[model samples]
Target: MVEFTDWDIFRNLALAARWTVLLSIIAFIGGGVVAGILLLLRMTKNVLLVGLVRVYTEVFQGTPLLMQLFLAFFGLSLLGIDIGAWTAASLAMTLFTSAYLCEIWRGCIDSLPKGQWEASRTLGLNYFQTMRYVIVPQSVRVATAPTMGFSVQVVKNTALASIIGFVELTKAGTMLNNATFEPFKVFSLVALFYFAICYPLTRYSKYLERKLNVAG
Candidate 1:
C-alpha cells in the first residue's frame, strides 16, 4: 500500500478540485447558451417548438443525473462511439444544466407583468425584438439569483463525474483513501474541499435574490 501523509492527500485533492471548478464553468456556460435558445423558442407562438422544449426539459429533469452520465459514457460506447469520460461527462452536464436553466428562465419570463408584454406590442416591437431589448434584460435580473443558485448545484453535481473514472476531487479522494487506508480523514477533506468551492456561491445567490426581490 502506498502511504500518503495528510498534506500529500490534501494537495492531491486540491489539484483535482481545480478540474471540478473547470468542468462546472464549462457546463454552466454551455448550458446557458443552449437554454437561452430554448427559452426564445418557448416564448414564440410555435406550438411544436414549445412542445419540443417542454419534452427536452422533462426528460433531463425527470431522470437522475447519475443515470444520464452512465448513458453518456457507457451506453454511448456500447453503440460503438468511443467518447472520453471527460467529454461524455461534460456533454451530459451541459444538457442537464440547459434543461433546468430553460425551465427557470421560463418561469422568470412568465413572472413578468402582462402589461409589460402588452406595452411592448403596442410599441411595435416584434417578439424577438421585445425579448432582446426589453423582456430578457429585466428577466435576467430576476433570473440572476436563481441561476447562481443553480450553478452551485452544478458544481456539486461534478462529484458524480468521478464514477466515470474522472479524476475530479471526489475521485481523487477515493483514490487517496484506498492508498492510505484512511477513509474518514480523506473524506472529511473531500467535503471541506467541496464546501470551499460551493459555499461562496450559495451565499452570493442568496445575496442576489435579496437584492433583486423580483418576486415583489
Candidate 2:
C-alpha cells in the first residue's frame, strides 16, 4: 500500500485545485456570453422567443447538474463526437450557468422602474438605446451584488464536474482517497480547497451588495 503523508495530500490537492480554477473561469465567461444573448432575446417583445427562453431556463434550472454533466459526457460519445470529460463538463456547466445568469440579469433589468423605460421612449430612444443608456446602467447597479453571489455558486458547482471523470479538486480528492484509504484526510482538504476558493467570493459579494445599496 502506498503511504500518503499530510503534506503529500496537501500538495496533490493543491495541484488539482488549479484545474478547478481554470474550469470555473471557462464556465463563467462562456456562461456570460450565452446568458447575455438569452437576456436580450427575453427582452424582445416576441411571445415565441420569450417562451423559448423561459423553457430553456426552466429545463436547465429544474434539472440536476450531475445529470447534465452525464448527458454531455455520455450522450455526445454516443453520437460519435469523441468529446472528453473536460469538454463535456465545460459544456454542461456553461449551459447550466447561463440559465441562472439569464434569470439574474433579467430580474435585474426588470427591477428598473417602469418610468425609466417610458422616459427613454419619450426621449425617442429605441429599445437598444434605452437599454444601453438608461435601463441597463441602473440594472447593472442592482445586478452587481447578485451576480457576484451567483458566481460563488458557479465555483461551488465546479465540484460536480468530478462525477464525469474530470480531474478537478473533487476528482483528485476521490482518487487520492481510494489510493491512500484516507477519506477523512483527503476529503477534508477537498472541502478546504473549495472553501479557500469560495469564502472570499462570498465575502466580496456581500461587500458589493452593501456598497451598491448604499450608493443607490
Reference-based TM-score, model 2: 0.96
Clashes of each: 0, 0
Clashing pairs in 2: none
Among residues 3 or more apart in sequence or in different chains, the pairs in candidate 1 whose N, CA or C atoms overlap within 3 Å are none
| Location of the lowest summed lDDT over 10 successive residues in candidate 2 | 207-216
lDDT of each: 0.93, 0.91
Q: Considering every candidate listed, which one attains the maximal lDDT? A: 1
Q: What ranges in model 1 sit over 4 Å off?
A: none
Candidate 1 Cα deviation (angstroms), residue 201: 0.4
Q: What tens digits encode model 2's per-residue C-alpha lDDT throughout 58-176?
A: 99999999999999999999999999999998999999999999999998887777999899889999988998899888888898888888888888899999988999999999999
TM-scores for the candidates: 0.96, 0.96
